[model samples]
Target: MCSILHIIGGVMNIAEIGQKVAQQRVALGISQERLAKLSDLSRSTIHHLEHGTLHEIGAAKLFKLLSLLDIQLKTESEVTKPHALEMASRSASVSYKTTISPQELEESLITGKIEPRTISHLATLIDELPLSLIVLVVKEISQRHKIPPKKIWSHIYSWANQFKSPRLAWQ
Candidate 1:
C-alpha cells in the first residue's frame, strides 16, 4: 500500500527521506553496516536518501533499496488487472524459440533503474529459463522432494511469488 506520501511532510531538503528510511532500518534491527554489505548500496546512499541529498535516485534503485529493507512503495492490491485473461478461452502454445536478452538483465544492475514489476517478472523468467543453467535448479529441487523433475518444476512454477519476484533479494 502506498504509505500516504508521508515524507517528513512539508518542504524539506535532501536526505530527509533517506534519514527516515535509515531510521526505519535501524528500528527493524538492520544497521547501515549490514545493509550496505547485503544490498551493495553504499552507506552514503543510505545516508543521502535519509537526508534527501540524493539529487536523482532512479525509480529502480529506490525500489530495490526499499525492497531490501522490506519497504514496498506501491501495493498491488490497489491496482486492477489487465482483464485480458477473460478473453482467453483457448490454451496458449508458447515455444522457447527466442534468445534471452542478457543485456536486459545487465541493464538493471548497471543503471540501477527498473520498473515496479520488473524484479518479480524477472524472477519468473529466471526460474523458467530452460537452458542448461536452469536444469540443475529443477534437478536439485527434484532430488530434495523425491519427485520427478517435471513435477518439481511444476511445483516451483506454482509457488513463485505472484505479486512480485523476490527481486534482487534472493540474488
Candidate 2:
C-alpha cells in the first residue's frame, strides 16, 4: 500500500534517512518481515536499512520501501547547513580578534588538547555556541577520529565548567 508522506526537506545523510524510516516503521507497529514482504524486499534488507548498516540498495527497491512506509523524499533549493567543522570554527571566531581555522579546531576537538593560542576561541565556543551545533561537531569528530562521542562530550562539559559558561546547554 502506498502511503503518502508530504515533502521531507533538509539535507539528510543515509544514516539519518534510515533512522527516520525505522522510526516510522516502529510507530506504525509494523514488523520488518511484514514491511519486507509488502515492499517486495528481504527481511535482511529491512534490518540493515533500519540499522543504517546497508551500504546501498537499488533506487527502485528503496522507493518501493519508502512508498509502503509513507515517506516521500523531496529536494529543496535552499543552501545546506554548514559542516560541523565550519560551524565550530565560525562560532569560535565570533567575538575574537584572532580566527580559529577549521583544521585547528578539528585537531583540538579530536585530541582534547587545546592549544594555548586558541584557548580564548575555544572558550568562546564553549560559552556561546548552541548545544545542537556542539553535538553535531562531537558526532562528526567522534566518527572521524574513532573516539566515542561520550568522551568528547565529557571534555566539553569539563571545559564548560572550567570556563563558567552561562550557556544553558553546558549546564
User: Which tens-of-lDDT digit does each residue in 99-145 have in candidate 1?
Assistant: 22444433332343444535443444444443333344444434544
Error in Å for residue 10 of model 2: 10
lDDT of 1 at 89: 9
Candidate 2 per-residue C-alpha lDDT over 33-150 given as tens digits, one digit per residue, 9 for 90 to 100:
9988888889998899889999888888888778778887776643334487798898889887889998998887767788888989989888777766777788778877789988
Candidate 1 segments exceeding 4 Å error:
1-16, 74-171
| Candidate 1 deviation (Cα RMSD) | 16.6
TM-score, structure 2 vs. true: 0.52
Top-TM-score structure, candidate number: 2
Q: Count the backbone clashes (under 3 Å) in each candidate.
A: 15, 0
Per-candidate local distance difference test: 0.48, 0.79
Q: What C-alpha lDDT does candidate 1 achieve relative to the native structure?
A: 0.48
Best by lDDT: 2
